[model samples]
Target: METEDMNTDRVRHVLTSLMILSFLIFGGLSAIILITDTPLTTSSVSLPFAFLFVSAMTLIVTGQIDERPKLTKKYLRQWILVCVFMVLVAALAFTLA
Candidate 1:
């Protein structure tokens, strides 16, 4: 039981670390886009915004899982859906760009 708990802790730590890194990167990109003088277009700004959204969602999921470690699977499923949404957003951005 102790080992299982430790493993889950480690997994959660790794997940949160990755999410933080992604959030920083995506947030930076979004900030850069917003800071620019160029006019914002759907194609020009959608991908970074989408990434920022997904990163935020993942952070939320990580928090939920941290509160109830047993719900890891449920949060993971949500993470997968968020990833799919990211891909779709990327495709749409490309099409529009």
Candidate 2:
């Protein structure tokens, strides 16, 4: 049915979002670690928030993909929150370190 297809698409979207998140989180962190020989500090805390933003942006982007109604708002708000949190973390990290 059409509903089933839509549901499947939504699931696919969420999965893709998660995959993208992992890339930004694990991959970015690994790269950062390799580049900088330093232990994690508050400065690194915003990294996860950035990852969330990237993943949310990915969902919004990529040529108009279908979104589930329930997830749409959740993801949007999460992105916003992450952005704000990242900003705070970056500031604190720099000052503290």
RMSD of 2: 7.0
Write the residue-wise lDDT of candidate 2 on 1-97 in tens digits. 7786687567557757675765668577767766887676655645654565556555553223353544544655665576567657756766686
Candidate 1: lDDT of 11? 69
37, model 1: CA deviation in Å? 2.6
Which candidate gets the maximum TM-score versus the true structure?
1
lDDT of 2: 0.60
Q: Which 10 consecutive positions of candidate 2 have the poorest summed lDDT?
A: 61-70
Flag clash pairs in model 1: none
TM-score of each: 0.76, 0.38
TM-score of 2: 0.38
Model 1: how large is the Cα RMSD against the reference? 2.2
